[model samples]
Structures are given as structure tokens and as C-alpha cells.
Target: MTNTTQTGFALDEADRETFRRQGFLTFKVLEEEEMTRAWRTERLALMDRSNAVYTEEWAVSGNTNISNYDRHLDNDFLADLITDRRITDRVASVLGPDVLCWRTEFFPKYPGDEGTDWHQADTFANASGKPQILWPQNSDFGGTLTVWTAFTEATVDNGCLQFIPGSYTSMNYDETKVMEYRPDGINRNRKEGGVRRGFFGYDYRELQIDPDFVPDESQAVPIVLRPGEAVMFWSTLMHASYPHSGKTEDMRLGFAGRYVPTSVHVYPDTDVVEEYGGKVSLDRYGAVVVSGENRYDHNRIATRTTTGHPFRAH
Candidate 1:
């Protein structure tokens, strides 16, 4: 296993304890120049979607809630981002040494865009109606670790993330309950605080176990991030975002790298991903092992990039 202190991203006993209780942790991932380089790299990557794993005009906006999934397989910058010890080391601390980054996504919010609705995911079956990750039967945890990095600045006024601390234990929404997708549902609902938010055209409220249940905004905390900063949280945590008030012309962009232990099964019994009103084949899909050994053969492992570059977890 890659030593944590050597990479300066390892979690101490205190750090691990904090994460265990809070269900999330925040830190800076890239230096200033590194942040600049990542921004430029992602910008150039978006210009050409030919090499992207998922191909479909499947997004509500030009940024957030889109179909561009898993660029780490084809893009070197993203491949490096997934395996960066600044991320992997800490993730390994929580998920153990044997870890795999199974998914990555880009969330962009333009001025006047609606905030992402409050939600939590266990198997990530909320949108696809299929379990994307299944934990081992012996394990107690069932969620993936999501590391969300800010490519551009994210503020509450510009749609920053919000989380309800210690709310990762019990689930309010059932992924088994299917919600109808409506493209025109954007910016339709005005919650208690006049927050314009929706879950990619579907009302996350529909999956709530209680039809009349509502999230407590009083307990919500804003996670404002500067360029290159990141926050890691359980996928099962109660989380949401703020609406982009459109006070600024600059758009907010967030890149999320999702990690799990090697024993977890990714995209179980699936060949193609259908979501956001678009479909994409899984022929080129492979999980990138970020640390230790991948003893489980159920998942298709991507040890190297499409360009034949071996992935190093340092």
C-alpha cells in the first residue's frame, strides 16, 4: 500500500474518527498552478466529446446534470485525478487499502441554474433504476466515497454543495422507487426557502418514504470551495446544493471522483448505462484500482489508460 505520510494525504487516527462520525471530510487537493492546469485541461477536454465514455446529448444544461461520464478512462488528466494520493490515500483509509475508483462525473452550474435537489444514494440506483455498486454481504457499509473537487470556484450564490451532518445512517428515499423523468421539470419547484432545485428533471421528493416529508434546511451546511479544493462524503449522506443566484457571470464547475473497496461490485450485471434520457454502452468501461490489490475478479479492471499508460497510485 502507498504510505499516506509520503503522499501528504493520509488520514491520521483523528482524521479517520472525524470522518466516521461526520460522514464527510474537506481539504485542498491541488496547488494553485496545478489547479490552473486542471482547469485548462478540463476545458479543452469538453471541447471534444469523441473520447468520452458516455456519448449522448443527455444533459439538461451545458454543465451540471449531464451525460459525460468516466473521462478518466480516456483522458490522462482525469486518470491522474482518480489515482492521486491526495484523494486515494484518504479514501483508502476509509474503504481500506484495496480501493477502486469506479466512476467520475462533471457537475457544472451556470448562472440562473437551479440547485441540485436534496438526495442520498446507496447503490446509485436513483436514476438508472439499477444497482450500480453492490457491497459484499459481510460488509456493513453499502455506499461509495464521493470526492467532489472544484474546478472553478463554488459559492452558495453560485450553487455550492450543502450537507446535513451525521445524516448518512438512515435512508429517507428508496432507490427501488422509480421516479418519472421530465425534461421540462427544471426550475419548477420552489422549496420552503424559495430555493429553485430539482434532481435532473425528477423530483427527488417522490422517492421519499414519507410522501409529506421534507428536509430540514436548518441543519444544512454550505460547503463553499475554491478552485482545487475538494470534499469527500458518503454517497448515502443527506446532501444538496444551493441555486446559482446568477449574481456572477462566472459559472461553477465541480468534478466528482467516486471510490469504493475492491470487494464491491460495480455496475453489477449491466452492459449499458441509461440515464438522463440517454443511453451509452459499457464496452469500454473498467474500474481503476487506486490502491492495494484488486482480488475480486467480478469487476472489469482498468490497470492502464486507453493510451496504454499504466495507472500509478502515487
Candidate 2:
């Protein structure tokens, strides 16, 4: 890991502590003008084609199928944003400089696409048969730092993200049962409270409402970000997005990067691999290292290793 003193966006001790507890953090106005210029140039080239994918609602506005320097196609900008000196330094401050950008995803909420269900962060990783995240240690290493950068203004009308502020510490819901909430209901299981927050392909409607689920709506502020503003949060935090209520021409566009320590193991099961199809794996579903605080090659997958203890319990 390179010394971050020159990276203009180093994180202080307090910032690192916040990330350790919160599971996520964000750095605003860190991208340089030259970087942003290259991003716009490439995107415009992609848009020149008459059949650009952005025409759809709820899809990544510009390019849907980008080449995989990493899964989700680490476009020049995406890669820069993930390993961004600002972001990486902050990550290193908490998880140590020996870090890697594990995953990056572009979440584009179209004008008509329904918002995803309320859920925690661990379930999002597709790391084989075991749960996406291995708790305790998984929760440690500062959990996973998700950098949410806005490509367009994300207002309440355009489906901004909502979260249960202090919910990161809760025991994440069971993945097997959560899968039952998918649209197909393939993995549904009995829940003690009957509040089945959807997963896999499940829909939110199937969830049994937690009558005591009195979410602090007041604390759940709607994040209205400018084209370049962003927020980061812990993976375990309970969060959801609102549906788009903006004009037909408007849609919400943002990008996210998930980072994990290098010591985690990954699962190599094909079936599980299919579940997290778009992800870049170190081995099968083995852990992936995506971004770090230095000039590293893009989409560099580590050779499989049985280093860390496997995290199980689906």
C-alpha cells in the first residue's frame, strides 16, 4: 500500500473509527476535474450509438453491459472512484492499507422501477453457500465500506436512499429465509416475527410486517445529492430506496464500491456463483479484492487461498 499522505483525501483517526462502527463512509468532492473529464468523454462515446441502453427506466443510465476490468465493468471512472485516493485512504485508516476493492455495482433507479426492499448489508454479497458476510470478523475490519457516488442529482422525487441510522449493529436477517421473499418465493422459510424482508428474487410484499418495526422516520433523512456529492455507509446498516416520482425524463443514477480485507475466503460453488453472476471472484465464490489505496491493475483477481476461516450458516 502506498503512503496516502500525497492522496489529498486521507482519513483521520476519528473517521476510521466511524467507519469501523458504521460499516460505510463517504467522501464528497474528491474526484479531480481531469478524472471527471475522462469519465464524461468515455460515457459520451458510449452514448453515441443510436441504441444506447440508458433509454430504459430503472437501468444504469448510460452503459448497461460494460467490459469487466472488474464485475460491473470498472470503467475508468468507476475504477478511479473505487480506489480513489480519498476513499482508499479512509479505508486504509480503518482496515489497514493492505486493502482491495472487492466489488463495484452501478445502481440506476429508473423512472418506473420499484425500489428494492428494506434490508441490511451482509446479504448483498454472493460469496457461495455461506452467508454473504462472515459476521464478527466480517463485522470487524470495519465491515464493508460502500462508496455511493452520484452521477446525477438524486432527490426524494428521484428515489433517494433511506436508512435506519443505527441499524447496522442488528444481527442481519437469515439469508435462506430472506430468499423466500424474492418474486419467485423459492427460498422462503419460517421466521419468528414473520417479517420476511425479501431477498434473492423475492418481493417486499411477502414480508410479515414487524408491528414493532417503528423505524425512526425523522432520523431517516432523504439524501438529496448533487451530481458529485455522495455518502458511504456500513454494509450491515438497514437501508432502502424510494421509488422514482420524478418527470419521465428524470432518473436516479449512482455507483457503489464494496471493499473487504484480503484475509477473507471465497466459495467456489457454481450454483452460488450463478446467484451472484455479475461479481468478480478470486476463486469461485471466494472473496474478491477490488480497490485499494494505490496504482494497481484493474480487476486483479487473487489466486484462491484457504487463508481465513470460511463463514457458513445460510
Candidate 3:
């Protein structure tokens, strides 16, 4: 990775290539005290008791889960981070000047909270029935690059994310099946004897991490980052969050935002968009364009307000 001190921080070249080839890059210990404090303050101010944004299918009232959590971008601090120039500029370097923030969501893996199972995000790919962009093949035309920022120090014990390096290059696993998942607000059941599949808690044990071949053990890396440090991985990368086994009470509070070249198709099928009113725009989950691209044609900003506040300064 290319490492150079810029504006008092550094971005290594090797890390940049890791992001391009492997579909992920982790910048460890990059946040300053000021940035961290600002995020903490804004997050604390944004916390509230509610669970609405999540579909009724995935709504559960509990301190552990924040449903349909979005809209905090209005908070200056949080918005700054989501659209941070250092982050977005790097993304621009890859996807070109024309790009948009397609998605944003928080994955809080708390103590005693069983972690999400190993899965790929490809299910969201074929949703539009159109051909979803594939990596390696489309490396020239980059797709969604998700940045996972840690609100609190993320250690392996507290359920930091795990990833299979370079796995995005293959389509070894079928992502179309809607598997049964009963974690937090997301719960679904299949018909008797009906085959349930999808990236959920159900198939954690059955699927081979790599059925075709043995992977380089050295390449399967687990990332443990400090608060303010972020891990940027592709949407198609094979990744999963492990259970919280750390001694701390704080959850692995992370906010993920997907940035893709404006050229890629958003939602592929009518099945999802018809049920969910959101058009396949860059503002999925109200992800505003902090920078780059102006693909959002419809003026529906007012309707993108998010319910509840689960990310305020403590």
C-alpha cells in the first residue's frame, strides 16, 4: 500500500491496491481525537428509542437493535464522516468523478448479541432481475465500495468484521435464496419443507467457505480497528461479523456506506422497488451525495427523513 503523509495523515499505496484487487482495504488507527470526539457527540445526540425504518418483517423493539436507522446525516458531524473528503476522494480515485452514495446502514454487534452469519451481499444484486455487476470481470468498472467505520474500538472480541480476501472475484455461492434469519428485527419463516436460503443466520454451518478450492490461510484476515479507523470493502466481498466476546459493554458500532460508479444499475428488479418505495437512486437509505455525481433526478429529499436516533454522543 502506498503510504504518504498528507494533511497530517497517510494513505499507503499498497492499501489502495488491496482495495482494488481484493475488494477491501482497512485503514487502521487513522482517526484523530477531534474526529472521534465529534462522532461520539453526534452519535450520542442522535440516539432514540424506536424501531420503524425496518420492515415489519424485521422490526423488533429492543435496546440491542435499531430499526430502519437513517437520517442522522443531518447531524453535521455524522454527515461529515459519511462524506469525508479523505474517504470519498479515495473512492473517486477508483470509481471516477461520477459516483454516488448508494446506501448507508449501521451494524451494531453488541455483547451477548449473536453476530450475523457469514454471507455475501449478492442477494441484493439480482433483485432487479437485471444482471448485477460482477467483480474481477468488471474491475475496470468498479461497483459499490462499502466503508465500515468503527464508532467504538472494534476488536475481534467485540465482533469486528471478518472477510475472505479476493473472494469477490468469484460467484461460488448463489445469493438468490431467502434463508431463514431470526436475528434481532429480521425474522422470516419458509413453508414446510420449503428450501430457505439467503445470507442469514441459517446457513452459517452448511455452506463451504470455499468449496472449489483451499484458500491461502494467510489471506483470510480478521480486522480489528480502533474507533475512527475504517475498513473499506466491496459489496460483493465475502464477509461476516462474528459474535461479541469482548469484555466491554459497547457494541461494535459501525456505519457502512456503499459508493458505486453512477453507471451501474441500482435495483435490478421490480419485485423490490414496487414493495419498497425507494427508487434505485444514489440516495438509498437517504444517503446524500456529500460529494461526486449528481445522478439523483427526483427531488424527494424531504421524504427521506429517518425515524429514531440511536447514534448520539454518550
Candidate 4:
């Protein structure tokens, strides 16, 4: 990796080559002790969503995945976390200098919780039914870059991420296909390998282009991470996680920050986000420019957090 004065953590040619071939890269982003301490304290603060951007009665009504979306827009620590140079610098090296952090979400898996279903996202319409982001017609890429950070120990027995190398070049599921959302289905599906998995409340297999197709688990690699470590990957990469085996009482938490070039239009032609069996107004939604400048005005940009903390670009 190359660390220049201008590019804080930019990847070198060899590093970039590896990322392109594997579709994912793992690196240390923050001090382990500091990250654990911060998460312990911030976890309590995040419970209060009174100042969140999406604070509609329905949005805050339950503990749905939608409720965990975009906390960086409300919390000061999260706001800084999304714009941290350790992340954006490496992201910009692959996605170009001009980038926007359009969304962030917290993924938590408690003991006995089901693992996530194997999935790949391009337009991100698998759940919402409407495309959340749109790339230019001539662009070569369609999906955003995702930086997922572990806020706690991520072990195989406690729900660590799994990936299929080089699976990002082609998509296996059709995003336009509709999937039924059955809340009761959570933790109920036992797949071919007898692994319990589900996608929030929806069945990701319903969107498969080939009904009989199955992911080659033989080639899947588990990503074990220490607290404060992060992995960056293409959103189109085939990825999933193992179930928390109840071997330990500790819950595994991951924070994901999604990034894209300024040319992309986020939440195109929509002012509301409806997914995960809940709907929320996007009146206060704005993408943060983490590095370089956003030359396009197609997306709303947030210069500061909801708590009035300014977002500094790398």
C-alpha cells in the first residue's frame, strides 16, 4: 500500500491488482481497544433516535433494519467514522478521487441469530422494488463500494463475513424480481449445508436468475476480523455470513459505509425510502462527500451532521 501526503491510505499498483482479482480487501482501520471502547459507549447513545434524519413515527416504531440505516447522519462519531481517511483514501484509489458516502447501516447478530443469505447488490432494488441508486448509462460499474468495519470480535462461530472471490464481475440475481417479505421466516430457513440464513425478512433466492442455482460453498472464504478492522469490497461481490452459534453471549456488530463516485444519483427520483416493512421520508437525507469534490448536483449533499458537527473530507 502507498501512503502519500495527498492520498492518506491509497493502494499501490500491486494492492489494487489484488483487490480487482479478489473483489475484496481487508485492512486495519482503527485501534482495537479504542474502537471497542467507543462502540460500548456509542451503542447506548445510538438507542435514542430523537434527532435522526428519518424520525417519522413509522421509521422509529420498531427495530427493523430500516431503523438502523444512516445513523451517521445523526451521530457525531458515526459522521466522523464514515469520512475517516483510513477508509476514504483506499476507497478513492479504486473508485476515483471524487466520491460520496450515500449510506451507512449497522448489522448486528446476537447469539442464535441466523446468518445472512448469500447476496449481491447492484441497483439495490431487491428489497425496495425501486432502484435506490442509478449509474450513468455509459459507466462500466453499477454497484457502490462497501466498507464494513467490525465493532466487535468477528469470528466464524460468531457470524463473520464470507465471500466468493472474483464473483463481482457478473450478477447472479435479478434485482427487478420481487421477493415476499415474511418476518416469521427469520432464522427458519436451513439451506443445503444446514446453515441457518435469511435476508432481513425476505428470501434472497426468490430473485435468483436461475431457480436451481446454488452458491459454491466449497469455494467460500470466511473473513475473521478483530475489533476496529475493516474489509472493503464491491457491492456486487457474492457475500454472506455465518450464524452466531450461541457458543458465546457476545453479539457481533458491523458498520457498513457505502461509497460511490459523484456521478451516481442516489435515491433517484424519490424523496422517500420504503423497505424492510417500513417507510421513511427522505426530507433530511443527504450524501456526504468524503473525498474530493462532488461536481454533480443531482444528489443532495450534507455538509454537516444532524448534531451540527462538520464532516471533514480527506
Candidate 5:
């Protein structure tokens, strides 16, 4: 494994080759004890979202997916986590030197919760009907690099992430297609393999380019992780999760920080994010540059958290 003085865990050429072939990589980014302590405090503190960047009345619709969107913009701990060198350095190794963290979200699966539907995100327009991120016309890639950290121990019984290796090269679903968000539809659908799954409230199958195309579950691999461990993968990879079997009372939580090159335009032609039965204004939204300098002037950049904590880039 090759390591750089600046980036202690930078991916070696072989590592990059593996990621290119498999479309995902797993690594340890945070200490278990530190993450446990920090999450214990931060989870309670996050309850008071009085200073959150997305504070519109509709943004707080209870239990909606939008409720936990972009907390890194206000929470100091999350801000530091997103810009952590361990993550950004590896992300930069794959996506190039200049990288921006455009989004962060909390994925919590309580006992008895359904698994996320098998899906791939390119432009991220499946449910919102608007392209959330737009790559340059000549670019070869189309999706963000999502670094998903397990804030809580993730087991197959508790909805651990599942992925189809080497499934990132081509998109099976069309992002341009619209998916109806029916809040009442949660936990109601089972796919071909009888895996109880749904994408929040929307059925990801609605966006499938070939409605008859069912994901090959035989090739799916479950990723069980200890708390503080993380896996970074292309957003276009075929990924899902196992349903929480109600075997454990503790909820499984995954924190995802999404990164893209500076050349990409985040939230292109929009000031609001509408999805999952709620809408939020982007008035206070800005992409945080986590590595290298951003030479593009297209996206709004945030140098500090809403609470005045500066983001320290690698």
C-alpha cells in the first residue's frame, strides 16, 4: 500500500485499480470509541435544529427523508467529519485533486424498517424530477462518490448495506423518469427476490429503464460493518440494504457524505430541493470544498459551518 505524507491513507495504484473494477472500497475512517462518544453527544444535540441551514416550515415535516438532509452545514461534528482527511484524500485520489462535498445525509433504520430498494443514482432526478448534480458535457463520469460511514454497528439483521460488485459502469435506471413519492407506500413492496425494500417511500423500480429487468440477487453482497467503519462507492453502483429484521432493538445508522469534482455543478438551475414528500430551500446551502482548490465559480461554496466553524480541508 502506497501512502503519502499529506494523506496518510492515500490509495495506491493497485487500490485504485480495485476500486475501478469493483466500484467500491471499504476502509476504517474513525475510531470506534471516539465515534461512539461523539455520536452519543451529537445525536442528542442534533434534536434542536433551530440553526439548521434548511429551516423552511416544510423542511421539518415529521419523518420525512428531507428532515436529516445536510446537517453538516450546521453541526460542527458533522462538518469536521465530512472534511476529514481520511475520507477526502481517498475521494480525491479517485475523483481528482479538487473535490467538493455537496451533500450529507443520515440514514437510520429502526427495527422492522424495510431495506432500501436496489437503485443507482446518476443525476439524482428519479424522485425530485430535477437534476441535483450535473457533470460537464465532456466528462466520462456521471455520479458522486458516496462515503457511507456506519455510525452504529451494521449487521445483516439490522439493515446493512448491500451492493452488486462491478455494477457502476452502466445505469440500469433512468434518472429522467419520475418516481411517485407515496408516504403511505413505505415498507409495502417486495421485489423479485422477496426482499422487502423501498426507496424511502418511492419504488425505485418505477425509474428502471427496462421494467422487466430485475436485479440479480445472486450476485448481491452484504456489507456488515463495525461502528466508525466506512465504505466509499460510486452513486451509480447497484446498491440496496437488507431489511431490519426486528431482531435487534438498536437502530442502525449510516452517515453518507457525497463528494464530486469541482467541475460538476451541484443543484444545477435550482434553489430548492423537493423530494420524499417535503421541500427545502437552498438559500443557506453551499458545497464544502474538502480537498484542493475549487477553480469553478458555478456552485455556492461554504467555507464555514452555520455556527461559524471553518471547514479544514486536507
Candidate 6:
């Protein structure tokens, strides 16, 4: 595992203790024409959300459930793939050298959709109830370090990302427990083992502090990416996915990119993020250091990229 590689890609020494006891990590950062030119400039920047930093929420006025969260502060190939250094130098080698790529979303399952539920997120507050990230009152635990990536070929029939390995220090769903946004309960519940997950319409087992727990899917796994591949996990980890199975007509499309460690607190007293039912307004949000130097001025950073692209830190 101490098999190394450098000049911009990292993690060796037994893959950094196997990513500090398996929070997660996959490879191949991007190729295949940089995932077909970042999915053709993210489908022409999602049909012009007019410089989107998340204007309309559930994406298309159609509701495939909704996520265009930060769009890397208005896309410059997702702001240089969210400060790429093979993902901010392997998440600044597990969060240290001043990292900070505060959010960037866009999941998109499609075809028959539904899958993403298991959930974990340390203070993402499950989904915007508050505390989008705090970490460091002497730090016992903090989460964000996502990265996701595969904007196209994921495949376990179309959904992909599953995880569970070491279960990242276990929180078992309870980001201060909230969960209840039912945009008509998205693909209609369906999970007493029939599978077809759901979180976009919120049912992450209803904030499961333990309402009959359950998620030992034989220690899950399936991450299968290909078009530009990428993984890096631990948004608290346990994760979930796998329901697309419309037998394929191309849809998977992940693209996360969270990160943290500029001494945390990206959205402390948040300004309007709500959740799947839709809301959004951290009012021109910022946070994009991406590697070092941001020695704590609390938050709101953003150096260059409302469309200019100079996030360059790593």
C-alpha cells in the first residue's frame, strides 16, 4: 500500500493507513476527455440556470429530486474540479493543510431513480436543518471530505456508489434529527427490503436515531465508476445507492466535492439552505481555499471564480 505516486496525486504509506481505517477512496481522477468535457459543460450548465449558484432547486421544473448545490461557485469546469489536486491533495492528506472546498453538488440518478438513502453526514444536519459544518471544539469528529466525481459512467445498473466498509466511526443517522420534507415522498417510499431508497424526498429512515435501524446490507460495497472515476468518502460514510436498474439508458452522474478543514464552520449560522422541498441562498456563498493558507478568518473566503477560476491553493 505504501506504493506511491506524486506530482499532484498522493496518498501512499499504505494508502495513508488505508485512508485512516477505510473511510473511502477510489482512483482514476479524470480522463476520457475529462469525462467528456465535464459532461459537456454540465449539460450546457444545466440549460442556463442563469449563472446558477442554485437558483431553482429540484433542478428542472420536473423534479428528479434536486441538487445543483454550489456548482463550484458557478462552474469553471466545476471550479477546476473543486480545487483539484487529485482532490485537494487527497483531502489535504485527510484534512490538515488548510483545505476548504465548501460544497458542490449534483447527484442525478435518473431512468428509474430512487436509490440514495442510507446517509451519514456529521453536521450537514442531515439536510439543512442547520449546522452545515462546525468541527473543532477540540474535535472529536467532523465530516465533509466527499469528492464523489464520476460524471457519467457509474453503473451498478446505473446507480453505483454504495460503501459501508469500516462505516466511518458510526453515527447511524441523527444529524440532530430532523428529516421531513416529502415532495410527495419522491419515488414513493418502498423499502421494507424491497429497496428503491429515498432521501431526496427525505425518509432517511426518519432521522433514524434507531427507529428499527437496519443497514447491514452484508456490509455494502459497489462503487463502480469509470468515466473519469473518483471516490474519496467520509461524509461520515455508511452511504447508499443501487436502485437505478432501468437496465441502463445512461444516467448515473455523481459529482459531489465537499471538503473542509480551514478550521471548519462553513455555514455556521446558515442563511437559507432548507432541503429537498427546495430553498437556497447562502447569499453568494464563498469558502474555496482548496489547500493551504486561510489560517482562520472564520469563513466566507472565495478568491476568484464567479466565472474567472483562480481557486488555486494546493
Predicted structure with the largest lDDT when compared to the true one: 4
TM-score of each: 0.92, 0.65, 0.68, 0.95, 0.95, 0.31
Give lDDT tens digits, candidate 6, residues 43-103: 8766666665556644534444345677667667778788777778777887878888887
Q: Which of the two candidates, 3 or 6, achieves a greater lDDT against the reference?
A: 6
Query: Which pairs clash in model 1?
Result: 64-108
Error of 2 at 241 (Å): 1.1
Give the per-residue Cα lDDT of candidate 5 at 29. Answer: 83
CA lDDT, every model vs. true structure: 0.83, 0.50, 0.53, 0.90, 0.88, 0.76
Q: Give the residue spans of candidate 6 off by over 4 A.
A: 1-9, 16-49, 53-70, 73-81, 86-116, 119-163, 166-182, 186-197, 202-214, 217-231, 234-255, 258-314
Note the residue pairs that clash in candidate 5.
none
Cα distance off (Å), candidate 6, residue 134 = 37
* Model 4 C-alpha lDDT per residue in residues 135-208, reported as the tens digit of each score: 99999879989999999999999999999999999999999999998887888756746799999888899999
* lDDT (tens digit, per residue) of candidate 5 on 1-314: 64777566789888899899999999988899989998999999899787787776564565478878888877888988998988988999999899999999999999989999899999988889999999999998899999999999999999999999999999999888888878897877565478789898888899889989989989999999998999999999999999999997999999999999999999998888888888888887889988999999999998873445343222
Task: Give the per-residue Cα lDDT of candidate 5 at 46.
Answer: 92
RMSD of each: 3.4, 9.3, 7.4, 2.3, 2.3, 19.4
Candidate 4 lDDT (Cα, whole model)? 0.90
- Across residues 1-314, which tens digit of lDDT does each residue of candidate 2 receive? 22346654666666656655655555564444544565467556444323221122213322232212232221334534665666665665656566656556667777755554566545443222244433235343334657677877787777777776667876444444433313333224322222222233454333324534544555665667777666777766777666665466676777776666555432222332223212222332222343343233323353322332111111
State the lDDT of candidate 1 residue by residue for 220-289, as single tens digits.
Answer: 9999998888999999999999988999999898999999999999999988777766667787678888
Model 2: weakest 10-residue lDDT segment is 305-314
155, model 5: CA deviation in Å? Answer: 0.9
Writing each residue's lDDT as its tens digit, candidate 3 over 225-289 gives 88878888776676766567647887778877777765554444332231111222223233355
Worst 10 residues of 3 by lDDT: 273-282
* Greater-TM-score candidate between 1 and 2: 1
- Alpha-carbon deviation at 143 in model 4, angstroms: 0.6
